[model samples]
Target: MIQQFRRFCAGLIVSLSAFGGFAGAAENADLLLSGPLFPAIETFHLENGMQVGVVPDARATFVTHMVWYRVGAADEASGKSGIAHFLEHLLFKGTEKFPGNAIDRTVKAVGGNHNAFTSHDYTGYFQKVTREHLPLMMEIEADRMMNVDFNAADVDVERQVVLEERARGIETSPRAQLSAAMDLALFKNHPYRRPIIGWRNEIESLNVDEIREFYERFYTPANAILIVAGNVTLDEVKSLAGKVYAPLQNRAPAYQPERPQEPDELRMRQVITVRDPKITNESITITFRVPSFRTGLPGENEAIDMLSEILSGTTRSRIYRDMVIDRQIATSAGAYAGSGARDDTTFALYATPKGEVTLEEMEKELFAAIDRIARDGVTSDELDRARKRLFANAIYAQDSASGLANILGRTLIVGNRLEDIRSWPDRLRAITPAQIQAVAAKFFDPDKAVIGLLRRPIDFETASLKKDPA
Candidate 1:
């Protein structure tokens, strides 16, 4: 994973340098258009009710084909926490027409790769191959749209795999445990409180029938979006998609009510102690509820994003500069704002204090930085630097076929148009210093934040002889 991440970062840096020259022009165009700086995408709906979006970039011979299902862990019914994720795993097991290892064998034979991921708002499966294989990839994805074969034995095997994943991801890590607890404490009735991997007992008890039911309900053409990007013309993609995906009939969209709003946090703090011999360090996480990408108005979401960047987008960010570098109180510190499809979101700060530097000291500095931003607002220079970093990162993302597919699918799934994906660099460039400050002041309130600490257990001695004499 670390190697993969390093490769990804390296590739991003190269792409950013190459694309930097286009930033000024893109920003100017965005200002004139009132939204994105790029031309509109060619979007059309198939007779089967599938929405297809094409962004014809003929820069390379590679094409990215993605099928995005508009249901994720958030759409799981009560007592069905991990069904969505389980279905994601099962899709690769087999299908009616392709059966067994057909997808893997064929993709590899054609010099292509395929994968999928499940999030709170959506699940996506994609493949990247040469333009010549676009039609074959599309047909393979469409074949498994609703033709997955789920057996009881397969369910049992995958369930254990998920359990092991949870153990590695949450159970064994103190930080992960604290994060899960914080999420539960943060939301009272929202499904976001449930982990995307689902609870252990819930996952263990889930059967084949439940998984199949979820697939039938949410994996319909109407609830899915098809994105094809690469060295292909819009007309070619449309014609191929019509032939491949138009056969599936539509189904009624899933209907769910709005997520219940979380009440204002009067005062909440949690301290979790883990007893593991291997544990030698402690960490802290502070989370603040903010607006989701979908709920906020145009540019509103960007403002919060800019605020997060200003706080701890990089080593030069305020938190890192103050706590990690200047004072040397923390080993590492950073901030994150989750851009998802819900109305409410979280802005989190994660830190690992230096030895003998108490979590209290770390929390003090973290809150102080946020308070300063809320009071004085960020400077124009700080905001501009953050914006430039984001723009650079966005440009860097254009190199990877998988990254492009993810960006398009995620933005569209969250209710934004596909055009927003191309114009994101321009939008990041246009955010003003004052706008970042305004959002910081509104959403960075201490009262709305949840502070959690993970630490080793404290030792205590108890009386013995004195009590016996009494």
Candidate 2:
């Protein structure tokens, strides 16, 4: 199965903050700093240039084996918009050795589950099985990594699946339509503007040759990372990987992402309106282009993260309290700063009005809330509370071994070092109130914003009639 598009542990970051654990924040930080973020993560490389990370946890008997390819939709050729994701679907068709549906049946017969996902920066496939079946999973994944075979017929069938997936996920959903519009307006030249699933026309035009070329070029040991987390030691993983994955040779030169860079001065504030008859409840979203962790200054990304938490990370957050609890104009409101991309990323605020409130009213309130923070800055209490919650969330994230695997894979694939991941706790704790206010004032400018509106066509007609009284 192709998992939904999610960057980092966005759900974990937001949902875990509301739990009570402030007293232990400092203690947890001290404990984590005493060693690696989690216990015993041993990483090494094969002669074929494949990097492997082994995280040993003996609490459970199951193991999660993941292979991450360091290429994604952002690395596609100019006209080949959807090739990265389309190839993801095709990889499951079959390999010459595994044959048709053999891998799927083999994993399921053992009561294991498997899935794959594609993002702007990487694509990954993972399977979870018991320790006894770990070697089998590795052999299957290793086989397909080099020997994935597909015909024109397979390509056609999977292309239809990809198209239907796009329809079910994006075409029929009003919010998805609005999000697509916002991306098109938000990014002027960067490939981030393209949908990860791809545009409909471009997807229809893709052929088997293009996909085969892509697979041969990028799907090599040199361009991939293997992450195994569960009941296994570094020595065991090293032995199994040496036997199974070591023989695979690199087909291409070392992986180097030649993605076109976003211009330094790409600034604009635009409105994107998406009206569909299916939309009964209207909403508004505002997105601002901000520096990602890979591109920002020393403390910029951390400050943006703190600012997001203080603004609307939970029901008790500033925007939600002001709109839903105090002013009573919105039913829901929140904010997110996506700082994990390879290039510049987004900071977004969204609101759905309560009863008969107009988008204009909600937009004004949202802008006012942000402007107030930019001007007055956050109080010491708010800063302390936000930092504690974030710190607690970081500690809680280590509970799942698979979750740690995901964090490691996403961070490393985007050109970050493991030390950066280990040092994030201290860096986030050190963020000051002035720094948060400075980023809020700097990136939340009117000129760098993209406002998205989703409404029913009937609402537009009604508003037009009221404005002119015709």
Off by over 4 Å in 1: 1-41, 254-257, 265-275, 422-430, 459-470
RMSD of 1: 5.3
If scored against the real structure, what TM-score would every candidate get? 0.86, 0.93
- Candidate 1 lDDT over 190-231, as tens digits, reads 777778888998999899988887888888898899988878
Clash statistics: count for each candidate: 0, 0
Cα lDDT tens digits, model 2, 60-154, are 67899999999988889888888989998887778877888888998999989998988888899999999889999999989889998869999
Candidate lDDT scores, in order, read 0.71, 0.81
**Winner by lDDT:** 2
